[model samples]
Target: MEPLAARTIPDLVRAGAVHFRDREAIVDGAVRLTYAQLGEEVNRFAAALAARGVGKGDRVALWAPNSWRWIVAALGIVTAGGVLVPLNTRFKGAEAGYILRRGGARLLLVEDGFLGNRYVESLTAAAETHESGTSDLPDIVTFDQWEEFVGGGAASGGAAGPDVTVTPDDLSDLFFTSGTTGQPKGAMLTHRQSTELYVTWSALAGLVEGDRYLLVNPCFNTFGYKAGVIACLLRGATVVPQAVFDVRETLEVVQRERITVLPGPPTLYTSMLDHPDRTRFDLSSLRVAVTGATTVPVVMIERLRDELKLRTVLTAYGLTESCGTATMCRPDDDPHTVATTCGTALPGVEVRVDGHTGEVLVRGYNVMRGYFEDPRATADAIDADGWLHTGDVGVLDERGYLRITDRLKDMFIVGGFNAYPAEIEQVLARHPAVAEVAVVGTPDERLGEVARAFVVTRGPADPGELTAYCKERLANYKVPREFVFVPELPRNASGKVLKTTLRSR
Candidate 1:
């Protein structure tokens, strides 16, 4: 096996500038930056951050869509020895504000407009209420002023502050988990854990130099940031960042850019296969594909090889706590294994399912340090034995391949986004008409599973009224698709609501 190259994100940038100089590192819309140019911009941005009193371990929140500037800002924050707080693009004002205040972010880099929403205004208004009403909240910076933000250092000869001496254990990022119960908790990950995990991931995916990678995944998620951007940087691959995923537009990009790598959930491929004009675009350049978040149909794997002409197709499984890597299907694996299992554990990771209960337990360097500011919750997740009790149930085959059977928690995926019934129920409980609520995942043809809410009402309430109330509090994806009112919820003798019964209904 090839030895891992760099130790930190900043070191990776320096290495890329030396080896891949003059090569196109990023292509976002009309902006094309060479490795050298990217390095220069990162250095200047780091300097600008240093001038603003940002230092090691300071949190910098980034609220923006997928763009070259997002990439630059993330790298710049790491280069300056600051922790990156990535806000989900789908997050509404209150959701984003809660994270910012909890993480205590000092600076917020945001996009003024995206998908017809102005984030700066929405975030500012939300912050006014949730943010302790002090000057400690992050100072917002818009994308339009991005050039000037970096130019401040360029004007000063681009000299960043004295070396901060970051070690492997230094915190790299503070990623918040999708909380199912109440408020979300930040998962603390170190520099070495993230870099090492991605190195293993890149090797497993067979990423190579000169690969034209197309990123349709959101940059906030691990799929896009760690496996997408960081992996591309490791291999000297050209990054083609697409802000949104559209079948026709993706087909155009595949032909125009001669993209060799495409990785997304099953829905992404399904959309392409179902497109009416998929035949018109030349998708011959596509060679590698990595898909898994929701379920992967065996037919989709077959179609990828036979119909789409893709040479490599892989499926894997992971969670945010595991640095988005635990197991992956190998290149030589058969279609049956690829489709049915999440493949064997990675080189250094350990995955074992309980013999009786089938709960999956993981222990490895890839596991996060712990949840920030919530030691009790962290203890609940990772026990004293060093094993992370992933609330997922699975079974290991005779050959060591792992297949997930069920979730011990009531968490479900809504179009690849993890939705927790506890969180939704907590929000819905605020409505005057809702006396009690229980949420469960129901089957959906397109999105894999959608949330169906069961409610016990105190007064007259309609589905439309309940949905409108939820829309005001949660992200669109977390909103329930159907609402069924009942006189009371079925509960076990111990007073636990029977979610299984709710799901069955």
Candidate 2:
């Protein structure tokens, strides 16, 4: 796939309308549109935003799920020369307010009543308890009035694109951290950074023109917005949005829409395979899958190929700070390689494990400009030499395959040996009875710290049996000292296992 001629997000819309005018651009429930129609809708929304004083560099917060409207709203924000600030749907009322206040969002577009939750009301209720009160909240726009708002703005601007010039270097989106450990700091990305990266991502992931990609990932996430929606636009592929990831619902959509491209974490595949009614769904359309996490179970990759008949299953590694991508396995990579490692970095980007500590460091165009409005934090993250310290422990083999071991904070010391949970989890996941597992350190009298395996079993599994399993395969010092069975592992909306929560337990 050639690099997009248009550098900016807004210009991508313009180019798409002309090049893929007849290709299906979006599919959301009853709504379907061609690239031309999508371009028109984006133009209308941009005009409205521009009319409402959303000038260049103004921050506009968007709180919504995966949908056609969210795509248009996001594109419109950038097209109007506004910096997009996306709020996670899983965020609490207070969390939403914090991002809005911190990002200095002048306007907030929310989905209102989704899954019986009123976001605006929640934000309002949360704000009343805040020290700043409601005075700091941005103007709220609900999903119900979407048509009216767009029509009014289009009427004023008269169907022309917003009167603004967006350059490649202009800020495109402001992505904030999950704030699990502290207040979230925004990562600023320019148009060129996001556009250039995902264009390469789309190509490497085997995304092609006319492929129907079911985006189960949230639009608020880097993978969903850039790799899902924007990648589709960049590749002439169709965007099929799923608001929330439900295994059965995912199957239904795949069967109904003939979805060809499915990208998600490994948990998505596991849930689908375990569903009782999975085999009933016609999933022959699934061909390409892109998944990544702390680790990928080799068995799951085989099952996806054998049971689901997906041909191209790839693994990748990245962080939010890297614009959601750094390295990705190629389409032709073997299942074991795909399961065990994230491929080499993209061309022009550099990746190396720290010589003494094995922490992954990335320096490239895709690295975020810095943490928004926090010079100290930004300087701490990106060194003067331009290398961004990822804080992730990984191994870069001679072949350049990057194997993520664990987060530096998540590594455990058992006796005098180092234990990476991802490595242990990979071994445990091979057990027929084990569906998923997380290993964390717990204080031990003899060893100072020992690994405790939290297992979600598919079949009957005993702690004694698991201990012997680890003992036979792993070094004595690396074997988990305890095992706990649970119905499911706790995870954030983005499907990362909550190791912090597990350690607390």
Candidate 3:
């Protein structure tokens, strides 16, 4: 496998520009930029940021949906020696505002509109109400003003080189975790750690020169940012930026672009295979598929190979703390191994399970520096020994493959989106009618698991009313799909709510 020459994300972009100058780097709708062109744009963005007083160690947030512009903004921030704080696209205004404020971003790049929502307007309003008043908040730059923003820097005629010195250990990205308990905390990762992880990921995914990648996953997530875009840059793969995951649109892109790589949760591939019009699109170009946010059905693995005819169907296991790559299935592994286990650790990573509780623990260079500005939380996550206590219950088989059995934390994934019961319960508890509540993940046919709330109300309560209350505060996925109004919650002798009983009900 070819090795990376650059240590930082900025240097990586420059390396790609030098080696794959004329090669197409990104494709978003009508916009297509070659590596050289992308490099130029990134330089201009870096200059623009410098003009705005964004310097080393400053945080810049990207709130827009997936697009070529998003990739440019991310690289540009890193190039300018700024930490990229990516906001989730599905986040409600308050949710987005919390991340922006907590990360202390000095600049924000957001889309004016997306899927009928006025993102800029909502975020602007939310920012005003945020504890870190909008007065000191990041300058919100809309997508329509993108050209002007870029032009302002060009007109200034500032030097293309970075204004401040950048080191490998300098904070590159501050990814906020959607925690199972309490509010989100920013997980800090350095440039060296991120670049190293994705380079390994690219090789594991079998990415190579001239391959076309259909990136259906959100660019904000590690799956899209690191494995999707950065991995492509490392191996000269072309990226087709997808805003949302629509089966028809995905199939069209694959057939039209001859997309060689498509990686997402199992929901993506299953939707394609189950779609009635699946055969209408020529899917022969699909070569690599990397999946696994939740459980992987054995049949899903079988169909990816037998039905889709994909050469490589890899299942990976990771969390944001681990830079999103801890273990991954190999290309040559059998379907059963791929289906049953989240393969062995990468070359330099170590994986062990707690002998008593069976919680997976990972120790590696890929681990994040710590939770930004929250050393207490950081110490809780990474113990004294340097192993990241991955709060996940799993077992290492004789062959060293890991099969995750359960999550020690009260977090569950709904349609690949994590829904923490504590977070949801916190939102629900705010309703005047709710006296007490216990939320749990109940099995679902479509989405792997969805939130189910059992509420003990002070007065007469309506599930619809409570649902709408949560919608106002939380993302749509976090809103409980099914609400059970009960007199009291089942509890243990210690007075802790027995979530297992709630799930059994």
Candidate 4:
């Protein structure tokens, strides 16, 4: 009930079509939409990207997935003042042709054969196998000419919505990410740093107004486009997308969309609580979820509240240079404080931790206004006191709650102390046959580096009983001198764990 002084998201879709007009904003399967027909299909795709010339600050891109026409072409590319890059529907056309040529994207609007992969024949065979620098290639707009490109953008005689202004310091969305110099940079984000910090991340993840949500994370990540379609268009909820992530078609769309806000990634609620036809759906209208990890499994946060009766199961932390959120976890915390911490630090953000190397830094308006044009990797990631160091590793506690613990290039000194493989994969994800764990560091001429665990088991596990259950709860140089077990956990289509292909096996 509070989103309309809108600092642009096309003025929060024209003040959410006159304050949530007939609510139900987007359903996607049989395609429903409301909020005045999602503000007239995002003002007719921002009047067909201003009749295809697409001006104001340019840069378009958007390769599709999670539909409702990728939320009306990403709210019609920031409502035609354009910026919105997006891509990564698992990239690979030379990684979406180097972020549509390093974000100079003057238009792409793809979707050509989505999961069947024909994005303009894989960016024209990766620019004819020269694999990138697709010589300034933009202007494509496929997906069967999107309804004849929004039926020839009804030029002005169609009640204008493309005269476009978009302020709150413009540039609304660029994204990219992947950088330990493996390339892909673009971050940008404004329109008042994404409509004023996702309305303070949807009022610290409470996200009210007729809820419903369920967008299985992946609108080119930022947890599915800024906490899944701009926090479900600032709270008049109902989004529903789910293009992929099929735990039997997500328990039949949260038992036929009675879904009540289910954010993802604690292995998407441990693959819907180890789905064996999870008691035949009807997840009891789930009721808010959130999840984050480096370790969340206090018996899967007490079985997502005693077997999927989830009533706000949060845990959080962030990265994507902080716009993917920074910290969270307070829906009356406890489940071992939402499974070993990450909460706190979102209100005007500022986290800190480096008491000589615990890394986690941050500092607010949700960080990124850097990276996009690289500037020497944005001064090696926001320094000179504007903090944002974040090379991962964390600690914080004293009620300041953070936790994180690994990735100062995945720490690992051993025998000289400092070991963090997410602190032994958060203590081998509390064994009971560890279902998915990672930990790395393997090169040991007698402990110059040791911890090796890889594990994925959900049933029969024994590396000497998981190295005597991490030598009875870790600290013998944080156990695991080698565990291995596999069957899944290579991950990198933004699902993370590749711990450099498990330290090259």
Task: List model 4 lDDT by residue over 200-296, tens digit each.
Answer: 7777778888888888777877767888777778878888888777788888888888888888767668778888988987889887888773566
Local distance difference test values of all predictions, in order: 0.85, 0.84, 0.86, 0.78
Worst 10 residues of 2 by lDDT: 411-420
- List the candidates ranked by TM-score, beginning with the highest: 3, 1, 2, 4
Which residue segments of model 2 deviate by more than 4 Å? 1-3, 131-135, 178-181, 410-505
lDDT of 1 by residue, 405-468 (tens): 8899888988778888888998899899999999999988888899999999998999998989
The true-versus-predicted C-alpha distance at residue 108 of model 4, in Å, is 22
| Candidate 3 structure quality by residue, lDDT tens digits, 1-505 | 2228677888888889889999999998899999988889899988888878888889999987889999999999999999999988888777777788788888888886788777766766676776223534568888888888887787544346455677878889988886667588998998888888888888889999999999888888877788998889888989999998889999999999999999998888889999999999999999999998888888998998999899999999998899988999899999888888999999899999988449999999999889988898899899998999888999998888999998889889888777788888887887899999999998887788999999999998888888888877777888899999998999999999999889988
Steric clash pairs (candidate 2)? none
Superposition error at 222 for model 3 (Å)? 1.5
Name the best candidate (by lDDT): 3
Cα lDDT of model 2 by residue, 231-284, tens digit: 998899999999988788999999999999998866678888889999899999
State every prediction's TM-score relative to the real structure.
Answer: 0.96, 0.81, 0.97, 0.31
lDDT winner, 3 or 4: 3
Worst ten-residue run, lDDT, model 3? 129-138
Show where candidate 3 strays beyond 4 Å.
1-3, 127-136, 156-161
Cα deviation in Å at residue 370, candidate 3?
A: 0.5
